[model samples]
Target: MRANSKEQIIEAAGVVFERYGFKKTTMDDIAYAAGKGKSSLYYYFKNKEEVFEAVVAHEAEHLVNEINASINVSKPAVEKLRSYVNIRMKRFVQRGNLATALNDNFLATFSFIEKIRNNYRDIEIDMIGEIIKEGIEKNEFKPVDTNFIAEAILTCMIGFEVPLLTKSNATDESVEKINNVIDMFFYGICT
Candidate 1:
């Protein structure tokens, strides 16, 4: 699709930010990447921070949509939970390079970015909580505190980011590890 000027600028800014991270990327770099003049970029985005915020929002929305779609399919709760973890891990592996960079620095100093991250986490937890509720209602999963379980699942998934993002290549081993975590979550570690 043909993106508008503002969308073009945001897309270009995402690329630049991913390459150089939030602090190092300049408006000029975004303008160059977008093939627009610096003034045009400024006209679209007041500054680099605005563009970066837009990028984070865009990525977060994309993730939420993907997770929702993955779980929305007609499947058992166990299947849905497994799909959720796999989809989340794959996306993290795909986008985590840039995300890790932005998170390591911007998450501490930028309250706006921090809010965006929290909002994303909240959305994820809500989605996972709904699945857990369904599982309990259907007797597929034992009755547990859905909120607590959702939060624990989210936390465990986030923990995978460190090892998954650090890998130069996401091999089958990465997929196996994520599935193993899901298995442990569902069935417990003890035989």
Candidate 2:
């Protein structure tokens, strides 16, 4: 079926792209990985760029789903926020393709990346804003601008990612640092 073949190609392409990265990967590479001829790839995707975009979108969607699944709605807002950050950071380090997509150099080279980044930001903002709103409604958190706080938390997380990416491995120290920062966010330093 056309749908199955297309999904097969995207799935294969994700592996190739993860291995070779976008700049080094070619149509032949993806086609070979997919166990199809190069022409078959052309039928489904206009070019390598389109294929790469699909791969990035696919991986991102997977991560978002994982994050959403890990959040327990019955839990307190603080725990929900903590769980979201822990799972997000842990997975970001674990998923090679995702790390590549978020890499600054990869982002700078692809025009399509801007749209993906913006879409991701919108999703994060909405998710975090909802949690913050819920916290306020339950009197767990002080009243504040939910959108602004959510945006700030998103910004902080992005800042955290840079340090994690630089290291050859994500050390426990790094994760501990993240936990400490999150703790600071939830409970101020003065106390």
Candidate 3:
């Protein structure tokens, strides 16, 4: 089946952005990659930023879909939480470059980019909150403020991104760290 023009543009843009980094990628490069003229590209995306935004959104959607699938698999809340964190961290590590680029200070300055980032975060937190709520309902986890706990869990994951995504630490070590966190989350550090 033939891909639609916008899908084709977004796919080409992802390749260009991944290869060149956001700062160096140009609209012409994406247009060329997509085998479309500049005017045709403009018809779908007003600028490189717009194209990049679409690419980021596309990537975010993919991540969310994966997380949702993982969550849907039969498991208790504790197991779901562990699976969620493991899957999320693993995916982030796989997309380390893109994740780092999105978190860059310069990119943070763009309102559109910031909005996209915020939207992705909110969706993730909501998903996590659902898992926590389920755990509580099932009596597998102690009752807590779902929103607060979800946000906190996500914050901790974000904090680990530097080392986890950068490969500053070994992948097994990072996974161990996540497991440790999940353990502490389910059972307090107190002896």
Candidate 4:
């Protein structure tokens, strides 16, 4: 099926892109990995960018799904936040190269990532915003600008992928570091 061919090419692209990054990856590289002639590959995907887009979509959607599945709204915000962070890191590692490529080529990869990010952005923000609202309503957190605070928490998550793979400290320690930074943001050191 052409759909299957598309999937194959996309997976192969993930491998090549991850190994060589966006600038270095070529259509020939993807075709070879996909076990097709470069022209045949073009028959399925217009170019490497199309293949790369497919991989990015698959990997990012997977990560968001895993994070959503792991989050338990019934739990307190603190525990929910912890689970959120854990799920995101775990999913990224599970995704490996696809994950690496997504981060590595964020600015330069297929514009598809921006589209995907835009599509998912609201859902992600709403998820965090809801929790912040609930915590405030429950008196678990002091009343503050929920939206801005939610955005702040989301901003802190920016560090998750970068440090986990590159940091000298144990992976578990990064979670501690994340928690400390989050704690400081939510509850200042004055206490």
CA shift of 176, model 1, Å? 2.1
Indicate the worst ten consecutive residues by lDDT in candidate 2. 165-174
TM-score of 4: 0.76
Q: Each model's TM-score?
A: 0.88, 0.92, 0.93, 0.76
Worst 10 residues of 3 by lDDT: 94-103
Say what the RMSD of model 2 is.
Answer: 1.6
Q: Please give, for residues 1-191, the per-residue lDDT of candidate 1 as tens digits.
A: 33588888887888888888777889889999999899987776787777888887777777778888889988899889888888777877776433553347645687777777778788888988999999999899999999998999888877777777788396457767867887787899998
Error of 1 at 163 (Å): 0.9
**Predictions: Cα RMSD each:** 2.5, 1.6, 1.9, 3.3
Model 3 Cα lDDT, one tens digit per residue, 79-171: 888888888888787763347445777778778877887888899899999999998898988889999999988888888887876794477
Question: Per lDDT, what order, best first?
Answer: 3, 2, 1, 4
Per-residue alpha-carbon lDDT of model 2 for 91-151, expressed as tens digits?
6666566667776575667888777778888998988888888889999898988899889
The prediction achieving the highest lDDT against the true structure is 3
Off by over 4 Å in 4: 37-40, 90-123, 137-139
Instruction: For candidate 4, give the lDDT.
Output: 0.72
**How well does candidate 2 score on lDDT at residue 165?**
64
lDDT of each: 0.79, 0.81, 0.82, 0.72
* Local lDDT at 21 for model 4: 78
